[model samples]
Target: MKPSKNIVLIDSSRPIDRDHLLPLGRLRDLPEQIKRAHTVVVTKCPPEMDIADMFLWEQRLKMPAGIEVQFTTLKYADPLPVFPQEADKRYIYSKFAILLTSIANPRHLRYHLLSFYKISSDLEFRDHHNFSNRDAGKIKRWALKHNKALIITTEKDAQRLSALTQLPDEVKSRMFYLPVEAVLLRSR
Candidate 1:
């Protein structure tokens, strides 16, 4: 398919952290990009993401007067598992072990949800589960077994997956990656 001249792709995965607002980076350039595009496609936003403030910020930053922000749901490729316990160390330990050791684990789901929602820092073990491609492969297997859709992961994963020589056809067929871009929109 031909790339759309009218669309600009934005990575909603990156949190609105302080460093992002520093000086030079995608965050600083967002307002200008929004002003230029007639439509904006936000990839990786959680299902319930609210764009009210994002739009207001665009307007506040002097984005084009009538530009519109459109959201798209990019399926999370490796959705973390929705486990059923918080205090059961044995359960938590088992779940964590599955996430770390099993090829079909879904523990990342918790982390993703937590991060996406900007959950309180008071939450414990925030830095745990350091994800890697090995874990991602396990996720792919899990998705296949569950007949689930492939996830939309970072470009890094897309690159790695593409280069994988032993990936199964089932997993390969489910791979649908959304690339990020910023472009000018023609007057419409």
Candidate 2:
């Protein structure tokens, strides 16, 4: 049960950060793993990433001379209703937002939203955090205080939020999630 081709993926943001001092077993063996990969993908890159940075990533990751490296950035889609039947589309036009995220890296989404909304409050949780009743109550309280603000979450977080049946109708009506997709950056 082996694939014909092996691809290795790395987060473009990792090598530049010096804080993660712990040596992961896989990180220690990345060079050897890259040697076996047919392609190497650098993910979570900035959309404006240029060829020069891509080349630098190769050097930083110790990519072999001939291995192909491709860069990808997460592209966010327009806000979609978390609960379509209860959602009010006008909330999308709000000038303020209450950001709710439970993912590893939310900076990308926050950056994108900054262009459209003045974030009133940003609530972050560890990656894949389950929404508890207390959490929903906290969010509901925030949404109530910022009456005109939209409640925005990631598509991943929306799935967990949607499962909470106890969320108030007012909260459900203003909730939306941004869908994100990874797009390859091409050198022009």
Candidate 3:
């Protein structure tokens, strides 16, 4: 099937291996099959990323010659408290934070966290994990234990939390989410 335009976006941080994660890592189409793409985007690029990074990926992805590769970076915005009424203090990342993440690749968030905050603790969950009562209990314990630590999560997780009723008010009050935007870095 032919499409009007073909743009392939591959995560820049994906480990270069077909069997990296079994079924999840398996590619639907081979590099040769995607040679017709008009644009190949390297998503989740770091601010310090260079054009040279594309050269390494070229050897790994084995793309067709002259396929334009564009780099994209995630720009983070200020942390927004989940419960405005209860969370009176604004998040100041320079203080302390405990990262709670349930995403495929959290390195982008981790990068921003490291730059802006002193990480007190980090809790990683399966991608798209739904928080339960027990999960909330654990989070509350951590937050209360680390009196000064601000609980942090991604905007996606924050969205998911909004639908969950099991998490305690205490945990919700302290939790905050950082919003991020993907910006394309035009090639020179």
TM-score of each: 0.35, 0.87, 0.82
* lDDT of the structure predicted as candidate 1: 0.41
Query: TM-score-based ranking, best first?
Result: 2, 3, 1
lDDT, candidate 2, 1-188, per-residue tens: 98998877777666523324336422645345567877888888988887788777777767666777788999999999999989999999999999999988888899999999999999898888999988888888888899999999999999999998879998999999999999989521
Model 3, range 124-163, lDDT digits (tens) per residue? 8899898876787777778888767778899999877666
Candidate 2: which pairs clash? none
On lDDT, the candidate that comes out on top is 2
Predictions in order: lDDT:
0.41, 0.84, 0.75
What TM-score quantifies how close candidate 3 is to the native fold?
0.82
Model 1 ranges with Cα > 4 A deviation: 1-4, 13-33, 51-61, 77-94, 97-110, 113-188
lDDT of candidate 3 at residue 106, scale 0 to 100 = 80
Model 2 clashing-pair count: 0
Q: Residue 168 deviation, candidate 3, in Å? A: 4.4
Query: Where does candidate 2 stray beyond 4 Å?
Result: 1-3, 16-33
- Report the poorest 10 consecutive residues by lDDT, candidate 2: 17-26
Instruction: Tell me how candidate 3 scores on lDDT.
Output: 0.75
Model 3 / residue 58 / CA error / Å: 5.0
